[model samples]
Target: MLLLVVSDNCQNTLPVELLSEVEINVDCSNPDSDDLIGYIERTYVVQDAEGNISDPVTQTITLERVTIGAIARPADIIFPFDTISCSSGYATDEFGNPDVSVTGVPTTIQENYDQASAIFDYIDISVPGNLILIGDDESVDVDLGASFPLFDMTFNVISVNTNGFISTASGDAVPDSECPLSLDPNSLANTNGARIYALQDDLSADTTEDALAGVYYEYMTESPILTPSGMLTGVSIFQWKVDHLEASGDYDLDFQALLFDNGEITFQYNEIGTEMGSEATVGIQSFAMDDNTTPLHATTISCNTPNSVNSLSAVGLIPPTMGGIDLYPFPEGVSCNGYSQYNDQIVYTDSCMTKILRTFTIGEWRCNDINERYFNQMIDIMDVEGPTMDQLTDITVSTEPFSCEANVLLPAISPDDDCNKADIVIDIEYEVGSRIENAIGDVIVEMPLGIYTVTYIATDKCGNESRMSFTVTVIDAVAPTAICDADQISVGYDPSFFTAVALDNGSFDDCGPVTLAIARTDDPGYPDLAIFTDELEFGCMDIGNTYEVALLVTDTANNTSICTSNLMIEDGIAPFFADIPEDITIDCTEDIDTYPFDNPTVVDNCDLPDAFTVSLDTIDINLCGESMIERVFTINDSDVSDVQLIQINFVNQLAVTGTIDDSPVEGCDASDAPAQTTVSGLVELDGDLLISDACVELTVTSSDASTGTCP
Candidate 1:
């Protein structure tokens, strides 16, 4: 169930009533004129069948109006009522007249000038300045002492025109064309380089009065006007104090153009006579006159209108009319022509020459829920500072001795700015003939041998940029490197195999291709008797001999280097007996002197067999009946030797034969019995007798003949 309590004042003890649905309507009207016409607060609470009650919620009701007769009146407005009849006690509602109030709010104007257009200060250079020109439609060249940037180009000299403009072209003396300049780049009025027209018109300068009617200028090392970024120090002021070329009307104009070091320009007018800028051109033209096809982009503040200031002020307020509130118009007679001594200034905000004006209305007044009046607001912003960097010098280096490129140490560069220094960006660009192989901070590798141009461009957050350039000259000065094998190189005794290329380990030139040459060097007291030719030729005598060799390496730049190495002509194969005879054994008795044995034929890899010497010797060993002989044959090729052996034997044969006669003696016990027998034979060798005398004697074994007689 829902419970609601209603009260004119919020009180917890008010009587509670049950609500049928979730929504409720409240009556907020005063019944009588003396009743309070305010808010009536109501408190609500909900409870369930379980005796649980929710937190109380309160709501306010407003009684802002009172109804009388058929009209409803605002509750805050009260009117006195009179009773028409005392018995009925009824009165008629009275209505009040419509009234309005208005108030004026000052109009506010704001401007945000970019880096190129924030210069607004003006300096009078007409007096105490150099009067360079004093004639009609005349121009002169003047030195600016320091570089001034304009249209992305820097200039140290300017051409001053008596018609109220300056040109950055070198030696420019041509006056601009007639007034009301066209936007065409090929027009005679739009000359070369950048042009700043403070006031361009048909004007003439009197020659006698140097100070009163001539083109005057002064270059200041320090600027008179304080800049917002404080980075623009140098200033060049060119002022024109001349009379317009008119027949009888007063057409005197005084204006000056200020050029800042940061490429910002400002035009200020001090006094404008009756002519004003009726036929004058006041603006800045970018550098595009060189090409006829390119359109001239200019910041034309005014073509032929009167010069004016960028300011806003409120005129008298216009009261609300029957239909709508009238808006106030701009103030009249607020230009240089209306005011004789007008001090008007025009600022170029960016390279595109954009002019921003911000207006705001504040503090509004309302009548019958309608806005009646408000104040206006204006804000101006300025930021025009370019980045700066240290100067860079040219670099010169040589390529590596063994390489075609050099590892150059690049200098580090950092750019700084007065504003937005951390947001500055640096871009590096190479010239047409320059290239980079590899890069790291402080070290760059593989730069070829040539001159290179490098440019550094630094830009800050405001699009203001600064640039610098330097040259890098890489030269070829170091000699080539000649390397030879550490160990001796062995080759066959041939000139083709023992060359400079074969003996070279790794020889090279860093910058280009290299040529190699080989020559044999002479060493005193060497063991070999070999002669060498200029082409490194050696005879067979040079085999198994080593000689010193020199390797020369030369580069395209004529740089040469020499290294020494040992060259050996090796003869590793030994001579062998080509037709050697097999070993044979023979008897010593045979004619060994006529054995028909000779030295064996010899063959060698690098030596002829005719250059070899052979020798033979016999060795014998005697036995009881035979003798053995060894015939050793040796062959020498001077560097190596070979040997072969044959064996021979001689056998000795001799025999002796004899016969004996038997004899017996009587007596077995006879110790001395005499029995003798004699025999003779011949001793012979190989069937030839050498001796013929022989003798033999025999003794009885058992005395058998004497024993039988005794029994």
Candidate 2:
């Protein structure tokens, strides 16, 4: 194993076959102490089964670097992590007997340190340190260790960590006239028969020991002392002489003390009761009148007229103004006798002393009231102040859907008061029409929609009150309206084409910005007809039927309204007339002069001849083979118009042959035909049609027996 030894002169290294725990002694930094400051580094060399040395591992120990001088130094502090009774707790020689010290490595190390170990290298004991006594004297440095004999300082032992770091340095102090002295129960109950104890100047919590071994106490009471103006003042004076334990031994005398009210040092003297100021002070008298002890003697003692004292037990006095100081702080298991109210009070009367001076000169004796003197104690209550409320701002909110209740929000309000914020009481009130039925928090409240004035009042225990008001407004709500109408339209025995919107005058909203929608709610009047959105196509529909249409309208608030109208229908249709006989063929073999004619038929919805009028526009009967005729028809209904058509060929007659008597009639002549036929016996159609009035004639042929006109 590799072992490193460090010293102030130099460092040394060596490899050893076997090694146990290595111990290094480090010296403190104090100049007066005979110790060295150094460290030893240890490295473990691993060996295999064959006894061969392997890789070696090493650990480093760091030196403790402590700050010294005016900087706030980390001194030894004892928390008394557990409770210990005063009697046996202070019996231990040091602060913590058998205390637990640093033995293992800390989970984390300080940033300045390169490596860590359970043991420390160097410790700078000269870096000023303190010795603390739990609740006793203020922390005092270890440099004053030489003065421990003067103060009778004592301790069992000090616990140090494996790293040589100490968190607590506790010890007992020697009793003296100055510092580290206190009253046991600091406060005294104003009621009858209240008493307090005193603590030794030494920093020990041993209740069985009394530091005031040669001290004695006396009680006195008197009426108020008046000023030159006889102002009915509240001041009184107390005088006392010095006393001693032994003739030639040193003793602490001429000490100063302050009076208190409800654990607070009293501020005003003459202005006692309700007239006391924020702060006040009393003087401690040091004028010596006589010498009672040998080495040093306290002569005369005086103080400001008004002060607080032990108890109210004298005859004509104000209950003797209850308050007194004993020897030790009230113990945990001890009773306060008749002063149970001040049981847990801890009084450090040493804080009140301004100064303590001692002398070895002997003095002449004139008077001796060393046993007792007179001091005034007053019975006064502390003055209390009231609280104040801050200004409150206004609030506004909107109502929830379909509800009359308005949702209001109030900001946080904090009041300034002598009492705590939680102690201040808050009250809210709403005006007549706006009462809150329910409240979610300090801010959220449910109330009817209306103009309302809210009052917020805050109060404290002192009866001081403050108020503020705000207004809340709620709005009105309503809906929109829709109107639609179906136009009255007339058509023949057929569906009509029209727009529903055209017939509609649109819609109206109570509030503005409304939406309108149109839909055809009419029954299927005709399967061939389709009602497409705003437009409709007139197809096959029942002649005279009325249809109903519906329109839907909605407002921005989602309020809907529907309106409807009717569609009127009628059937006044015109007749349909078509000309069939465009051409008529006639043969002149059966000669005839005149032909009978029949008119084309007309069709109407009623199928009545009287319902329409028909006429042939034009007709021609001549010897020619072809003729033209024009026809016209009119409907009798006033709502419909007449329909008429024209055909070009009226009569198609041809004169092919003539009889012997009618062979070549001279009166009728064949003009266009190449071979001429004379006269016509009868005009008849060969295939298609022949009109009665359709007539044709034949001219004379080449040979004929009978002359003259063929008849």
Candidate 3:
């Protein structure tokens, strides 16, 4: 609606209608784009040291405002009461004569111009002048039409109702000449009742072309055929229904139909001789048809059997009140959806039977007829007593007057905000009168998995009581299962352990969470004990160690469900520098060779062993107190006997504290004198080995053939 580019330094103002969006492209390399730099530096009216509330600088030439408008028309008329009264839906109060000088005048003008038009106004802080709206350089001045004219031209008033729709004639207490009516139509100032009508072209319904006279209901009489003989009136509707359709295979359609003047009629179900049932429908048709055909728009109601028109797909629950199933939820848009108040009329049954009456008032707008009515059918389901923790509740039901599935029982725990709470137990003593024909199995029924009835009586000194019963049943079911994609993943951390997590397929039995137990089979320490309250948590496993992840899932009936695997660990990681001998001091400066050193042991805990690959050796060069000697030795790989590093720290057998080469290398025998025994092939090591003032060379070699030392 407005272009809101505001700046703190510039005067604040807004054009109610945006004209254009201006954008300056900075090449970042061009000097002509200096305005782009200033644009970024300029502070806006909504910008502060804290934050920016204004829209980001969104400037482009293509952005512009489009104009839209709505129009209104004014009118004046005269009434036949000698004074005109405004009757448009907007004019709530009547206005009398404004000027006393025209006291005899009967005409009046009624126009609500405020809401019938559009407006745009704002206060400007930039300049002391009226704002100008520029549309493509064409400035539209707001002051040009500061005040709007009441009407464009003079017009005559005339009524056009109760006749034809085609018209161009106009008038004021007279019709327009363009539309030549045989005579003048009725108007507010005219002698008859007539008003202009707006044609509804979008609607498809047929409306009365002319004014309707009247409507009445009547009855016919053949004997006394005269002027309005019966004066037909009070067209009434009839309705009825049955108590137990499966008992006598009949409908007890006892109805209470209200008619004209709050009158009523009760239609008793007289179909006691009718056996209305078939293989398809448990119940058959009734008085739905009149004169061999059903009334207009009348629907049929029947007790659904298998494969019938009103087929019962989901009837009462199978293990009715046997399994621990919760209550049913209310349908959408119903007043009972979350109705937590005790004053509410509805009650959910133990067998999950939602006992409710979807009642409604059918009106003329909905029925569209004089004698119209609506009927509500009763469906056979589990008794709507209340909720129960367990299906078979042991209670004392009397036998005074017994009605099958009468929704009679003890109180439930509660359906208060806490959904997890179970039902409550109470003293349920009842008197029931039985129907011999409706007796299912026996007075002492043996129910497999559902809530059953056991009739009995407990009368001491008081009078005899009616038939009573107790509900009993059996239980215990299978649990659920879990599945993972892979049997086992190797612990070599591609950093992926959760990706291989086992999933609960939730293949629960009819017992549901009861028969199920969840746990982590990988670690025996973590076990899921609770039914629905259990969850398996698996900790992270790394690459070095092999792991055995597992799960122990079972049902309430103690069914063992398990899945496990053994994973292998990975090898080959980056090798760190284990050890290198610290200070090796050479006493004399000779050839300065023989760089023989051993490495410290490289240990790791990665489940698997690590092998070392020696790289190029490092050597430090010395250039002090030198006789200017250049020493180097070419030792071949073939000359090296041991590939493994040797830990040689001691110098001699006597602990004489010499060097490592001083150890026994040449062979000595008792047959020969120890004093005469000599060392041979004593050579120096290679490389620039020196310790400042000391440097020596020695290369020790061993052979079976010995010779004397020549140092």
Candidate 4:
């Protein structure tokens, strides 16, 4: 649901689902013709991301027409009466102090307006009092200056009505042309270019309510002549002839001074226009101001005619002027050949320098006669004080340094503006890296890491601009990093288990490491070592042994790291044999041949055995009944000899004997040897064998033929 409210507290509700926008067109049926003024209130229903509806939010909106106030009133001015003297120099009131005048004192009655809290826009000065008028049609050279001494001139401001009607405070609204002028019926154009002629008035003329008391209006239809000549002394005022004046409305005819030879001033209405309401406007028309160089000589500043006031609001005296007039058949497509006269009216020449005219219609130049009343205020002379000359002081701007953590522009330091003065504008300018920002009073800058500058500019309402600069620096937010490689190692060997030290190949980091320590990971007892200083020790390991060592390095940023390598230990080796045997020899008469070979020696890398062994290689026997032998020794348990060989020999020599009497002793011992002769004998080679097969050629001589036929 949506709710709407009017300025008068009126409420209106509108129901809707999910929608993007809503629009309504209304035609205001206002009773008053004045500008429309009002505001509207709106309430919106909003849904949150959670699908929950929120309370209605309200806001006020102002309504307005597409266009308004086409016409603008001139700003009021109140200073420097009608005249000034050269002996009194002008002072500047740059500060615009309301309590006092430029002389640093209280002001008089004339200056009292300002002290009493009065405000005015600006004042202007015109020279040679009778050449131009202050409040006339825009096309008129109202600001034109005639030759006159600066001291002899007076600066004054004209008061205009809310509708820009010129105040008729002076009686110069009309001129004494010696004849009355009226619209020419026969020469009427289509709402434009109505010709006027002098009429023979049949009665006395009232200066306040006579022929010039009415107003005039003119508007262009299509693309009318816009030549330079057409802009000056032409039918239209300025180049803005279209959609402004319709030739039928009330116009102001202010006073324009035209001095006669006798120094007496007369008035005229060469440029007059209908008063348009605030919404009326004239298109832009450009014109150049001619540089004037006229000489003036002051002589008591004498004047012939005294300034007077005359009101012409009583234009009802001329009833025919209220309605539009007709002016046709005047001329067509005139050339530009200097200025000339036609039918006693101003005319122009063609491009060929030939005089020509164009005929067109005209319309009414007066407002409807509704009995409108008006009053005028006039002041002819007065005295005034000078202006003040105080100036606004310059401002200083500075700021603090910036950082990426904050990521924004820092506030300015010692930033100040002169507050005593009104309408002082302060601005700040920033440059981040290479980009420059628009000038502002203050700002939060969003930028990357770079150097920058800020400038502060202060400008017073009088258009005095001053500037100062400040600097800002933004730092980066990224951190430094490191890269590393694995640790290295080396190997060494000894006869037995030996201590090993780990070697390092080094590591790499963008930032150097503060500490590098290496520890033996394989064995818990091995101590860690500081890298680049000490070597890693792995004591007493077996042959072909290897262990893991880790390298821990830390950088200045407190980032820890580790890498591993190997430590190899080698101790395995073959043992060598020592103390080998030698060959030995013995004669036949020797008693023994067997003897131990010298004990063998074995040397090994890991460990040596306590004993070795020896063995015989061969044994030899000789015919003389002797023997010899060869021996060998070994260190290891293999048949292959670790030590040298040894050889031993043994030999014995002896004679043979025989004995045979054993059996006879039993039978004939008693009988004597002679009687029985049964003697028996044994024959022996060495100590043991008396052979039974030996034929005893014992000729024992008869001996034991009978005893034993032993064969």
Which lDDT tens digits does candidate 1 get at residues 1-711?
234544433334544433322323333332334433455566666554445555677666543332110001111221111111111223321211111111121222111123233444557776677878888878888888678765434677788888888887754455554344544557654356667777777777864543377888888888887444446477777888787777333326667777766666666676667656676776666554232533444555556776432211100101111111122232232211111110112233443122222221221211112122222222122334456778789988888765666677666677776445566666666556544322224535457888887766777666777777888888888888899984444334443345567767888877778877767667442222232222456556776677888777778877777888777766645566676666676665556557676656776556565655545554554444444455544555354555555554434343334543444556564444544333344332221222332211122233323444544
Candidate 2 per-residue lDDT, tens place, 296-372, comes to 11111111122321111110111112212221222222222211111111122121111111111111111121111
The candidate that achieves the highest lDDT relative to the unseen native structure:
1
Which ranges of candidate 3 are over 4 A from the true structure?
A: 1-476, 483-552, 560-566, 571-580, 583-594, 605-610, 617-711
Please give the RMSD to the true structure for each candidate, in Å: 27.9, 30.2, 45.1, 32.9
Instruction: Provide the TM-score for each candidate, comma-separated.
Output: 0.32, 0.26, 0.18, 0.22
Show how many residue pairs clash in every candidate, following the order shown.
Answer: 13, 38, 55, 47
Against the correct fold, how does model 2 do in TM-score? 0.26
Per-residue lDDT tens digits for candidate 4, residues 1-711, read: 234432222323334233323323323444233433355555566444446554666565554332110111111123232123212433433322111122221100100000011111111111211222222222121221222111111212211111122211222122212211211222111211111111100111122333232222222232122222122121211111111223332223232222111111112222233331222211100111111111111111111112211222100000011111111121122211111111211143221111112111121111121111111112111223221223323322222232223245434333232221444455666563333333343356565445556555555443445565555554433222222333232223342221222233444344333456556675545443333223454323444566666655554444455666665564334455665545455443333334333555665544534445655553554443434554555555444464333222323222224334432434534344434223233332332232331212222222343363334
Please, what are the lDDT tens digits per residue for candidate 3 over residues 1-711?
235555554435432223344344323343223323222122223444444345444333321211111011111222211012112212221232212122211111111111111111111111332212111111111111111111111112221211111111222122212221112122123222111211101111111211111111121122111111122233222111222223332222111111111111111122212222222111101111111211211011222222222111111100011111111121222221121100112334232232322221211211111211222222222221222222335743322111122233333222211111233222232333332222222233212333445443322111222234456333333333544323433332334443223333333433334232333344445544432223332222354455554444554545455554454444333323344434343333322345554444443323224334344333333333222222212122222111222222222212112343323344453223222123332232323221121232333333333456534
Q: Name the candidate that leads on TM-score.
A: 1
Q: Which ten residues in a row are the worst by lDDT in model 4? A: 106-115
Considering TM-score, which of the candidate structures 2 and 4 is the better prediction for this target?
A: 2
Cα lDDT of all candidates, in order? 0.53, 0.33, 0.25, 0.29
